[model samples]
Target: MNVAWYIWLWSDGSALQLQQPIVSTTRCDRPIEAVTAVTGGFEVRAFLFQSDQDNCGGGGVVPISYVAGVRDGWPVRVRPTYGPLATCDPQSLIVPLRPGGVVQLRVDTDDRAPIVEPAQKYDSLLVSELAVSPYLPEEQRGDWVLARAARGKELICGYVRMDQIL
Candidate 1:
């Protein structure tokens, strides 16, 4: 499921430009919302159109009717598979679960699972409140565990308390 991705940015006539507009099969008009370089690669946050109909080529123009209003930006990993510094290869932020990595979520009857943004207990944004179910373990963050689950169109990646997993 490896896909070609490019972080499209409107240059001030200073940065290097790509010979060809990076096209995506899943989205159109991918403007550079944010970019952060991690250990292995960079994580890009961009507003990806949910449509595959057309490639607007970064003109910032798309058929307005096709869009369902502005959606939340998603984080895409750009690893070594990228062509050049200006280009990127899209990867999922949430690591896939390995065999025997499944765990059951423990919560009270009316309690929802708390999924936070950072690994810390303080000042972390509450990403989502998931229901009790079988969850795939992505990674461990001290007293918290990073978990991944699909809740509609977006993939939920956040930390849950270690005591919440059974």
Candidate 2:
């Protein structure tokens, strides 16, 4: 199945939307330079996925929330919105990391209240990636170090994968 995902970034009360067109049948891994250019001091990556469930139908946009933070260091305290029809649990947005240091992130849909499943043929699932990242400094660019910095700064470097069921 073909999936289309839109990646956006929000920081310091500002939002930077990406301009890259992404499509994936299985998975996608790419840099979100579009947003980093404006943020100018962080790194973020987003990954979106399509569920294997069957489609229901009643189509409507849902709100998906993305949060990131140190695993055991602190609680995830970031909320980004994705989709108008997506719904995920609050715990899914937690970022998990090792005691020493690591960046972990979680994405989920925020279906404010609970309601019976829609009669639509489309299935509700989670589609997400790392999030958005702030632009990184030249000296801070490296292998694992870059990833660490991006995570530590709470940068957004993730993407979300959305599938349209016909």
Candidate 3:
């Protein structure tokens, strides 16, 4: 687990495999607490370090509320069937903007304005989304823009790597 996953909150019906309750140099001592039975599984309300040996500096506690837990069926691990974030293509960042597109908009606010640099010219935006132009010879269709929300809807009409899309 990376440092980003420091505060682990599980809302499902499964109990986290945690460090044993006993204090030892090998594992955290009683780091799990506030175990409450929810609709499905248990929701931990508190997690503390009972001993300084666990790196809590003696009674260090990270409250469960401060932690970011799954919101519904929380902690959803979506293995993208397509896009730069695909399970196998970790090296690929050129995702097409089509249906099942999982890449996020990386709009850079240059002086609080949208930077319109060409594709691959800027590092802030995705290569696929920035691959827009009126001169390039046409090819297959580009990726889809699925931005449905309450209000202020927008779409990215641009070029995309056909091979990267579904």
Candidate 4:
């Protein structure tokens, strides 16, 4: 089960083309910064880069969609034999995160933390941590955060404490 993965990305969140598939590889294993499911109803994933030296930019090179399985709504697992052209840019192939954009983020805890309702008055725990977006500052609840978690296939969203995140 040795599969090579490629993350095809577009800044504007454009659709992936089937005719020509372009992709790039990255050794950088960065946690997802934010996520949103508002791209015409489809989930949009994004990663944040603090500096250009981080090599997180896709470097003007566009990526193509593949038929392989998708992970985190971005990275796709393709066959090891599949060969796509390599990028000449200095930066690793990664799409930069935009302001107010969303990407899938992970909880920085070994123990499962409680997922609470953001709109609830009392501590209404839903489930443990699964996936989350960045801390919602607009909510003005400094300790509370908006998060999405799933047991199997069903996805759930709620507010979690900021201390639970990395």
- For this target, which candidate reaches the highest lDDT against the unseen true structure? 1
Worst 10 residues of 4 by lDDT: 81-90
* C-alpha root-mean-square deviation, candidate 1: 15.4
Stretches > 4 Å off in candidate 3: 1-26, 48-59, 65-101, 104-166
**Model 4's TM-score against the true structure:** 0.18
Q: Give the candidate order by descending lDDT.
A: 1, 4, 3, 2
As a whole number from 0 to 100, the lDDT of residue 6 in candidate 2 is 39
Query: How would you encode candidate 1's per-residue C-alpha lDDT over 87-141 as one tens digit per residue?
Result: 2112222233322233332111112332123232222222222222237343422
For model 1 the TM-score comes to 0.20
Flag regions of model 1 displaced more than 4 Å: 1-141, 152-154
Would you estimate the TM-scores of all the predictions? 0.20, 0.18, 0.22, 0.18
lDDT of 4 by residue, 59-139 (tens): 212332222333334222232211112211213222221222222322211123221222222212233222223453435
Worst 10 residues of 3 by lDDT: 81-90
Q: Quote the positional error of residue 32 for candidate 4 in Å.
A: 34
TM-score of 2: 0.18
lDDT of 2 by residue, 85-136 (tens): 2223322333332223222222222122111222222112222223212364
Task: Assess each prediction's global lDDT (C-alpha) against the native.
Answer: 0.32, 0.27, 0.28, 0.30
- Model 1 residue 102 CA deviation (Å) reads 17
